[model samples]
Target: MEVCFVVGRNGAGKSQYLIDQAKGNNQDSLYLCNTVHDRSQELKTSKRFSVKNTGSHPNNVMKSVIKKMMREGTHRLHQIEKILLYCGYASHITVTMRAGKIDSRLDDFSDTSSIKKLTEMIDNYFNGEDEISFNVNFGETSDISSLSKLENLLHQEKPLRHYGMVKAIEISLYKNNGEPVPLLNASSGELSLMTSLIFVLGEISGTNMILIDEPENSLHPRWQREYTSMLCSLIEYHEVKVIIATHSPLIVTGAQLDERVSSSIYHPATGNLEFSSSTNIEELLWGQFEIISPKSRFLSEKLAEKLEELSAHKVSLNQSIEFIDSASKASFDDGQQDIFIAARQLADSIARG
Candidate 1:
């Protein structure tokens, strides 16, 4: 009721959809999409929503914008040009006029401030001083009264101040007596996942539209699919709406493969994104994606080099130096050429990517 996922592939317009949805005709709610408001070409007609990427790079607009700027010279900003496209790991965030303002914690996506490049921004505001006034805490509860330290400080009538929250994350706890045990140390995957949780936890007003782009970043295969289910559950139980842009089959599977979940997906094509729906979200995501033609697949350079060496060395392999010598070997020219062509193609393709 409150949330709907705008699912699609990279560059397939998921971000634009969220912006438009957030900016509904009345435009009375807060909107957040880190950088899309500023980086997207649809900025003006985009209905003007607020967005932010907690894991933003020290730079703005993601790398794609930078590359475009380098090429386009002084073109209108993506937010203005409607040419903004996603590049992996871009920091973005925006917000438009909201009724009164929603919870602010929805911005957490990764260890953004910890990035050295971000230090300057966090320290100095537009006024060139540490004018920041907000709490970045490890606790999830909006009311600080529940936190031990915050409680103590409030009881003592002392000031409560927050510098920044670091790489804190969520973990499933197995109760040992009364205390909770951590699942494991953090990995990049865990960081990405926890950040997503942190983002949603902040904005959970029940029956709100929550959107995400590429919710599969940095997660393991298991986490990838589970994360999709997690988002779906959030939408269903809380009456929230969600939209996502992604390239992961695991995530696409979440929508298409899960009977318990309702989802839709989009893929990139020549002009626009092609859209599809599946009650079986998982099956759809895990669609029969196999190499139909073995030759169509590329090999790694290491494998190719090994093949080339073997092919050039004639009598297969032997303990004798006579059979294994590279320069001194007299081998079949045809087989050597064949291996060389395949290996070269593989090497070149890999290099291009």
Candidate 2:
């Protein structure tokens, strides 16, 4: 598995670069975006490519992939269980397939002993308050008998609505205490992580190339830090080249320098730059992110405007100095002392003039 981490500020052509790559090598390639403005939609003409619609619910794609795999007798129960567990949604997942509705029945109440045992069971069940049972159901919409037609529908943006011969995919997620977890109660980050994992480890497995844009969109900082490793562990066995575009420093540290390609770098040969984990985060911000100061952009812009106005004599030196002093003091933080000090020095020079 070869991973390329593309880092850059917003609108630096990161997503477009991925789109172009996918278009050029549309065959056996998968393009995914975790953004509403999915650029991969531009690749609609390329039928050989697997492109995800960021606007649609991720479950649509997940269900389709599960059906396709199920038809091939390759169950991803373990993989889905790992994804749910990693996202903190469940401790385990039980996948069951059935052609008809799934039903559960308690033993017939034949005697007093059986009734007493049932009462005890109910009491024990209620006692395990720490656990919950979550059910996720996937059923066929249309019963298409042909595998070729099933594959065609699975490739669509929404596969569940169309008719298919795929069996229902029922998964029950539970906690360590053996209680089910209501997967619908999961946070956006948990859902996003699970979706991305399923998308990668499911139908897109063994792909020639995988392009992911802004996978950190709904992920927490901790998940973002561990995201790269989790993804790699799932797909390391596959012969695939992965390209991830992100703005997170935590994600950047997940890959080595040779694996990182910055959009800010311009070279015909390569964009790889050494990104040592030993380097301080501040240097990463300054050099890689081009952040000159810890000050907010609003404050920096105001300071620049004040300096320009003072130089043009549009305001009194005392007024300008006082404004800069107050603004600097208001936005001051421990790490931004140097920025205020520089502003003060520039104000002093203007006052002396």
Query: Best by TM-score, which number?
Result: 2
Q: Ten-residue segment with the worst summed lDDT in candidate 1?
A: 81-90
- Tell me, by lDDT, which candidate is best: 2
Cα error, candidate 2, residue 33 (Å): 0.7
> What tens-digit string does per-residue lDDT give for candidate 2 at 1-353?
46666665666677787877778884667776777667576776332222244323554545555656656643344456567667655534433322221112323424546445433532443243422222332222222333333333334312221122223434445665667644445577876787667767665654678878788888898888787778777776777777777777666554433233222322112455432333333345444554333435655666788888988888777877787666545432567667778987897797678
- Please give the distance, in angstroms, between residue 207's alpha carbon in candidate 1 and its true position after superposition: 5.2
TM-score of each: 0.39, 0.55
Instruction: Check candidate 2 and list the clashing pairs.
Output: 132-179, 132-180, 132-181, 133-180, 134-181, 142-163, 142-164
Model 2, position 312: C-alpha lDDT score: 87
**Measured by TM-score, how close is model 1 to the native structure?**
0.39
Q: Candidate 2, TM-score vs. the true structure?
A: 0.55
Compared with the true structure, what per-residue lDDT tens digits does model 1 show for residues 63-172? 22322332343221222111111112212121111111212442463654433333342233212432222221211222232222222322222111122312221222
Error of 1 at 228 (Å): 1.9
